[model samples]
Target: MKIYLAPMEGLLDHLLRDMLTRTPGVDICVTEFVRVSGSLLPNRTFQRIAPELLHGSRTPSGVPVRVQLLGSDPACLAENAAKLAELAPMAIDLNFGCPAKTVNRHRGGAVLLDEPELLHEIVSSVRRAVPAAVPVTAKMRLGYNDRTRMLDCAHALTSAGAAELVVHARTKADGYKPPAYWHEIGRIREAVTVPVIANGEIWAVDDYVQCQLESGCDDVMLGRGIVADPGLAARIKGLPAPDWDAIKPLLAAFWDDVLIYILPKYQAGRLKQWLNYLKRIHPEAGIAFEHIKTVKDADVIGAWLAEGCPVPAAEPGWTKA
Candidate 1:
């Protein structure tokens, strides 16, 4: 089974992608969506979102990274995909699953699901424009507001030449709610000829098992789950889970990487954002975040982590959803 890292906007940037792809069982990493508008974007824009494009489109550990594009316009998406293909990424993934209001307001993400033909046109245009050796894929929610016409949408994407399809198992209106509707993916898989990857709310190995059983798809993609437990992908692949001590070095490495790549003013917030997710899995992370949540100084945060933020004997249960 292929385990992919979901492209979460604002969270799964290239820094985190580099970190997670180093872990075992992460087959591929998808960069956060590069928003396409009226015109072709410059090469610098693609490089900014996926700097790995400079180094054979693979993470430091040699895991492939696919560039994902989000837009509604067929010609513009094709133009951007053609330009990005020149960079030789592992694959091109089209984003039809984003639920952010800002993205939808601009006719960019899940909102396009309301018109299956539009989704087909956009995907087909990108598929034809890029080299045939470069695979084109699409990720989509069940629908815009409901599951009706979901089969139509699935068939539309496959007929449009998407090499693979990832179904997030919820409509745009569902918006990250409980019960990811994994069984719904089974329907899409049956309808389409292309491979379907299941994604949504897979937080643990048990959840991964259940998602596969329910969706009947061999491939799975993880998002927030990896943040809550950095060793989750390793665990899913039957590797030993990283204990608190093992996790500390990764946190330090992440801090160092962010400090080097990101500007000073934004570094602390990125660390804090990761801590917020880490708190769900480790007691030490909770204590660390509480103490430095308001601190904007990355140096101070680094000092605290370097000092070994005291870990209590017992950790709180994972709660965030």
Candidate 2:
């Protein structure tokens, strides 16, 4: 019955994490992956990426936010994991499922799946480095280009001391396409004794139910689906859907939080990134975004999101795509 929010690189920063965790049914929020290289990451960089760790490693509303690290080098990755463990977030999550071109080109993320022994080394090194009380979990796809070694990879990670595994159910080649191949996750769940969390192509309540039923997993991690529907996780848990009017106020409140917390420090590009997701809830919100499309100043974008977007209807099922 656990629900973890997937750590989407650009999409699930602190602003969105704060807003979503405020809604019902969210338990864990994994921060975006911190790319590790030859040495320990700068403490300032880790703090900026996951300031919630300062607030007790939890969301403002108190849901725990786990820190995630991405890298392929066993030694360096393990070193960074140790430092992150010192900071002490709820858990340390390893990212082996990112399919982004740059990460794959660097032999990090999902591309590491190509070599099962290497994946084992990476996971085991970090798992042993981190404190025993702090769980070290991993997220990964089936493979890079084929499904030939999916189950074996899952077994490798679990045997290497990964507390749990989140399977995105697609190979690196699938690249976020529809039909997330949930069956593959089911297969992985059957193969591993560690907890398996299913991810990908989950956009609605039925999708959540089907994922759990099909994968035989006790938990599900949501990404783009929750982005499209702010109240989605709540709805999937059978909570009353926020009326359009109620949600509009909440959105406005969320914008206020964004303006107060994120705008002054980050780029205007981040504002647009958030609006693109908000558009899924309030299509009209895009109009406000269009007005500021050419504006590069973060202050201006924050102003627009705060003052420009029209109030959305409060009734459920307000508009259809």
In candidate 1, which residue ranges exceed 4 Å CA deviation? 310-321
- The alpha-carbon deviation from the true structure for residue 65 of candidate 1, after best TM-score superposition, in angstroms, is 0.3
Q: lDDT per prediction?
A: 0.88, 0.81
lDDT of 2: 0.81
Per-residue lDDT tens digits of candidate 2, residues 1-321?
888898887677787888778778887889999999887788777888899878889988899998999998999999998998888889999999999999999888999888889889999999888899999999999898999989889988999999999999899999998888888899999898988999999888889888888888868898888876777888888886654445555556665666566645455556566667767676655764565555665544444445534533332422221
List TM-score per model, in order. Answer: 0.94, 0.88
Backbone collision tally, model 1: 0
Which residue ranges in model 2 land beyond 4 Å of their true spot? Answer: 253-269, 284-308, 311-321
